[model samples]
Target: MSDAQELAALLAQLPDAELAGVVGAATEGRAGLAALHAVARSLADTLGHAPDVIDVTPDTLPVAGYSQSETVGGSGQVGAGPVAPGIPVPPAGIPTAPSIGGYSSAGVPTFESVRDKVEQRYGTSQGMGELDRQTPVGRSVEEQWEARAEAARERLDQIRKSMQGNDSE
Candidate 1:
């Protein structure tokens, strides 16, 4: 007998009070399990009357002329009809994106090619040669720092003159 049937037989021999006591004791630490057991018992009682045999065949087969694939195993021989069951072919007239990666209708766009396309469609960035032609020669870092220091000194002189006038007042 199955473990469930054996358990049921053992439980049946217990007195009503003893069974109640056993259930009460189990409920303390195994409340979730007890609740699950109760639900399973209720479902078993409801569904025990009859078990139905279900039909599990497909409603319709693929049309006779429909061949799943043009080539089978690279043998160049076309399949006569629908091969082993698979996803149905999408209806025609639905627009689909082009395949990506190696050996497809459209070649995969490379970074350089994509960049060139974008530059051509949009405009190219300022080339170093063009920048050199347009801009004056750049000062060295030390010369740039000296220019900033001179500007700061002139600003400080102006501030000092303004403060002197305020102090006199």
Candidate 2:
């Protein structure tokens, strides 16, 4: 068989998740940085700039000597250390937040009206994918299990009380 076909056969043996992991690793490695640098250099050349003015945020890049697994599993340690404050500044032309539309004579614009206006401008009514401020975070598995057990105990206590009352009568 041809080399390309042989490589494809080998790759096909891997499951989708494993293949995706391989791809993610490749894109987050030196190869990825080199690719990004190339793109930035190309953009600079095209724009007639001697040096690229594009600045990638430090948080976006992987820290030195940290593996992908270590980075992914470090969520618990996230707010444990002192955090440096960073207020993001929007670009000159772009607004910091989407304009939810103006208050008409009827006061606040209706959802339909705001959606219509947003759809007209962006071709879709999907605003910034921010979570609703009022939506509470879900309970952990242990919390949920404890709650269920509590409810079950209360139900059993009620049944026992009713049985005792019937026996006395």
Candidate 3:
């Protein structure tokens, strides 16, 4: 089961008094977790990198027929229909940004290209580029395990020393 599920299960086993304490502690923990998540998300946005490689060939120009790249894996289907010479119209309310086709049709990036640029602009950071989940979440199980192991070792050493002291007493 997930950590969240396990946590919930443990919480369910608590009595009323203990449950209240747990709930209070959980509330505080959630607040801190939310703050950390926000920071991590913001950092990922700022530091995340997107590969920029749009085909700017004249044959692929929106005017000639090819559409700009939209989705992440899409190379952009060169529309068989005719294209106009004017600045391509994006959805209403979107900026009149310059067009990005083979011919550089003014003011219309494929949704993916636009996403890339936007990702570039405001940005997500992936914690020094270590295992950035595609969903822009935080560290992985390995990292969490490493951190927990270190803390556990420290606590175990302390307990061992305390037991030794009691034995001597």
**Which candidate tops TM-score?**
1
- Give residue 135's error in model 1 in angstroms: 54
lDDT (0 to 1) per candidate: 0.53, 0.51, 0.50
lDDT by residue (tens digit), candidate 3, 1-169: 7645765776688555454433333334356566654554444344542113212123423434543432223334455334433433433322332442422444334677767777776554544455454333544655787899999999999999999999999
Return the lDDT, model 1, position 124.
43
Give me the displacement of residue 1 in model 2, in angstroms. Answer: 46
Which residue pairs clash in candidate 2?
A: none
Candidate whose lDDT is highest = 1
Q: Per-residue lDDT of 84-169 in model 1, one digit per residue for the tens? A: 54443323432334443322334456566677678876554446545555555533554677899999999999999999999999
lDDT at 73, model 2: 29
Question: Model 3 residue 119 lDDT?
Answer: 76
Query: 145 in model 1: Cα distance from truth in Å?
Result: 42
lDDT of 2 by residue, 124-167 (tens): 32332223222353235547778999999999999999999999
Can you give the TM-score per candidate against the true fold?
0.20, 0.19, 0.19
